[model samples]
Target: MKDQGLSYRLTAGLEGYLDPADALVTALAHGGGADNERCLKRVTAHLKADVKEVSAFLGLVRIRELPRREDIELRNTAFLHELGPSLTGAEITGLYTELVRRTREAMQGRLGPRWAEQLAVHDLPTKLLRKRIGPSTVADLQQRLLRPDHVLLTDVSQRLSGVETALVRKLRRGAATDDVIQEAQMVRAHADIHRMKQQSLGTWPADPAIEADLDERLLLVARRTIRSHATDPRPANAIFDGLQTTLETSAATHDRWPLYARDSVLLMGRACAISDECRFDWGTAHESPA
Candidate 1:
């Protein structure tokens, strides 16, 4: 199992080098006599696309784009040569077939027929060096839980959802002063614009830690509202109303957010749900017969 795993890792690392090499080679093969220059130029452009696609795939698979060590390549070559011949031809073909499919899909709707022809790749010898390796179970799960592979996701989610809590706290301390209200308004406006920027940059799927923190904060705010305004239910009700409003607006705005920001919207939904549930529980407890 360990040897098989190492083989897979070696193949994954080799894939980046072989991807563009194979594209250029295939184009050269078709170049033949007359169209060599034109084919080379076309292949050059195709190579750029190939590099981009391959880089994205590598990132997705969490493999380094380029390894600095020289001996690694030699070792990989020796290992593959030693191991390649014994492997059945069918296994080799299946590997390349899957690679092509994955490459096209990773391009994310950009892989058209022209691109398919320009790359013009088929089963190559190096295809045996192409293997799909994924992170360990814990690492993979961690990645899925986090926000779009960014550390700032936690801060952003907190900042965005903090608006309502900030407002409630300000109101609870005393009457809703102009300065307090203005501060809350400013925070909300800033959060809205920040969200739009994140959407534009395709930074969807907020980190789970960030979302979890926001949910807890929102719930805390709801509980505080109940405690702080036991005599006047209006403020607590308003806080719940604000949570609902934010949730609805966030969902509607997601239609305009980038494809990558889909996870962020879900985070918003989860945060709102926590707030809503907290509010409902408070209301039910207050109304219970004594």
Candidate 2:
């Protein structure tokens, strides 16, 4: 569930920064074989910023970029929370030493000689095990790191995936002359069906369908905003950036992880699916009326 939850959060994070159809069209219009790369770059930048903010809220410091490893502060805090204040120095030290030995052996067995050897010297727990820090703190850290991958929960991934699949199918069935609004409505309808399927599976949350009818609305807004800006000579890039910023700013207002996580995943994932399906359609990219 945590894995799914994380996937959901990632989807939400993406929604904050991405305008699926706009991103796709802009990238293709760039005409340099940089469509995917360019679009992803923008998305990645936004995701990283959100991740950094989230990590900071969770008490991680000194992160220059999104880290793959658990922060020492997090590990220490979790450890202390799990183990009470009754630990003695000898008991803590003993536990740390044993854990280090076991961890090294496990790493060595799984990762081969070089990594095991590298970890033997460089691992945080290994180093901390030898330190004369407070016993309660070390003892606490010991227990916490033993368990891994704690996270919030959500079931948006599968739902989002279903929406994606249906979106692609819908787009592939579409005509070149199809209005963007019409396509948006079709995509939103398919997303609704997927939402119902998720609900039927009982994996979806009991929460209101915050995502319902949003695809049509986002597309409509995008069409209007982009068209409204068309009078500018450099309208294309401005429209794309403006729409993206608007979504990102709106998503950031979620303030809390769960709300942002579920809403974002739903918003971005469906938006992206629609965009991906229609990227080459060129019909989804509406020009300003002359």
TM-score for each of the candidates: 0.21, 0.23
lDDT of 2: 0.42
Give me the displacement of residue 13 in model 1, in angstroms: 48
lDDT of 1 by residue, 29-127 (tens): 333212345543554465676644443333323222443233233333222222333434454344444544665554454434455453555642233
For all candidates, the clash counts are 6, 4
Clashes of 2: 4
- Please report, as a residue range, the 10-residue window in candidate 1 with the lowest summed lDDT: 9-18
Best by lDDT: 2
Task: Give candidate 1's TM-score.
Answer: 0.21
Q: Each candidate: RMSD to true structure?
A: 23.3, 23.4
TM-score of predicted structure 2: 0.23
Give every collision pair in model 1.
Answer: 146-207, 147-206, 147-207, 204-260, 204-261, 205-264
Best by TM-score: 2
How much is 57 displaced in model 1, in angstroms? 42
